[model samples]
Target: MEPPRRKASFLASMKAVFWSFFGVRKRRDYEDDAVNLNPVQVIVAALLGVAILIGVLLFLVKMAVSQ
Candidate 1:
């Protein structure tokens, strides 16, 4: 008999999302994440990351234009 598998932690999912945003994930890591990560967690993390990126870009642009 096999033991039950554990779900991925929020931190782990966030790390996976971060690596994915940079487009530099290894195939082995991808496979591991696929098995461990929750789809909902991935989606939420991705959306938050994108929003943060956009906010940072807007802040930089505003600062550059104001100067």
Candidate 2:
């Protein structure tokens, strides 16, 4: 009988994804994430992070242009 996989929490997954976006992570952390993180949660987190980054950049550009 196979044991069920223990999924990491959403917050943990998001934190992992955030660090990934910043291009920084320890090898030990990456190994742990590979075992615990859910693929769907990671994808969602990555998308949300990208969207927020883009939104912030756009807002800053607009503010600069308006001045």
For this target, which candidate reaches the highest lDDT against the unseen true structure?
2
Q: What is the C-alpha lDDT of each candidate?
A: 0.89, 0.92
- Per-candidate count of clashing residue pairs (backbone under 3 Å): 0, 0
Q: Estimate candidate 2's alpha-carbon lDDT, on a 0 to 1 scale.
A: 0.92
lDDT of 2 by residue, 1-67 (tens): 8765857999998899889988999999999999898889999999999999999999999999999
lDDT score for residue 35 of model 2: 89
Question: How does candidate 1 score on lDDT?
Answer: 0.89
- Model 1 is weakest, by summed lDDT over 10 consecutive residues, at 1-10
For model 2, which pairs clash? Answer: none
RMSD in angstroms between candidate 2 and the native structure over all alpha carbons: 1.4
TM-score of model 2 (CA atoms) = 0.90
Residues 1-67, model 1: lDDT tens digits:
8754649988888899899888999999999998888888888888988999999999999999999
* Backbone clashes in model 1, listed as residue pairs: none
